[model samples]
Target: MSEAPIRLLIADDHPIVRDGIRGMFTADPRFEVLGEAGDGAQAVELARALLPDVILMDLRMPRMDGVTAIKELAKLGNTARVLVLTTYDTDSDVLPAIEAGATGYLLKDAPRDELMRAVHAAARGEAVLSPSVATRLLGRVRAPADPLSARELEILRLIAQGTTNREAAARLFISEATVKTHVLHIYTKLGVNDRAAAVAVAYQRGLLTLDNG
Candidate 1:
């Protein structure tokens, strides 16, 4: 005999999105669309009754957010795994949902095959993450050294060349006030207070060199 299909509960604010996702699963015998929820609150309610293998959660819902729903499910000791499915993959969105016990994270842009695979993985209590989300998590793990932006680096290079903030602003053709803001950010990033100290730290970090010598 064949193995039973994995049951799914999709939760999204849009009826159209829920329908579209349901269609995807309905076309395949490998998965079963148990129910659709219009909001996180409804998702939690439906989950109590449906007991699906995986819940495809959306982060921003009207009644209760996805993260909150995941937390509630955990509090209730529900065995079903939560798989976050949304367009957002920023740190603010990805980290909280995972911390709330989401078994997987897939962006809305993911290919259909990947989405199905994500659901299957989630059903088995395995971790799933969209490429962008995975990259974000990896970046968090190996946080960058200088958090300095490209513009900030340009400003730092000018400072290394002994240019005043005004001169740098003039060369960059930006407002002096804007340049001051970049300078402040550079100082904060380099952990320095003044221009000279900022320059010293930049050289120590190999962000600058006395190329003239």
Candidate 2:
């Protein structure tokens, strides 16, 4: 049996842009454009009503912006993953969208293949960002001071080196519970919510030297 097509809702203020996106997805058998909205409010309403598998949202729509829409949709308990498509690639746009619960961010000029890949990735709960944007965002942020104790820093360095928490604990002669506490502290100090972000922060802040392997 064939797999179900990925259901999508497209939201963009510009008719031509929305039409272009609609045409691109219509040509793909793996995707189905379930609905289209010309503004953020309509997008939120349609999303709540349709419950699509994914939403392709443009950031600067009139009436309500994509970020606001994303925030509101999240509050409504909508399950659809939001994938932000916008011309802005700066940290200002990318970070706010991510904080608003967007699962992915893609440039509006992204090739059809990349867009499709992002949509599918978002559907699976993975975070995606344009390479250039990711680089810029990662570069600007300074790493926090070693919030963890000296012992905890040792464990985090090991974890950043791909060691399992249990492995790190054993190597440190500490219990797994202690390692977990350190890991939590690392996350808190970094203001990051996931392992990937934590790793990026560690690498950028020089907490984990690249040659630590």
For candidate 2, the per-residue lDDT at 118 reads 95
> Candidate 1, TM-score vs. the true structure?
0.69
Can you write out model 2's per-residue Cα lDDT over 62-139, one digit (the tens) per residue? 999999999999999999999999999854568778878999889988988999899999999899888887876676
Clashing pairs in 1: none
TM-score of 2: 0.66
What candidate 1 gets wrong by more than 4 Å, as runs, is: 144-213
The total number of steric clashes, by the backbone 3 Å criterion, in model 2 comes to 0
Which residue pairs collide in model 2, if any? none
Error of 2 at 48 (Å): 0.8
| Model 2 bad stretches (over 4 Å) | 141-213
- Residue-level lDDT of model 1, residues 130-182, one tens digit each, is 98989988886787546789899899888888898789889999999999999
- Candidate with maximal TM-score: 1
- Model 2, residue 54: distance off in Å is 0.6
* lDDT of residue 76 for candidate 2: 95
Candidate lDDT values, in order:
0.88, 0.86
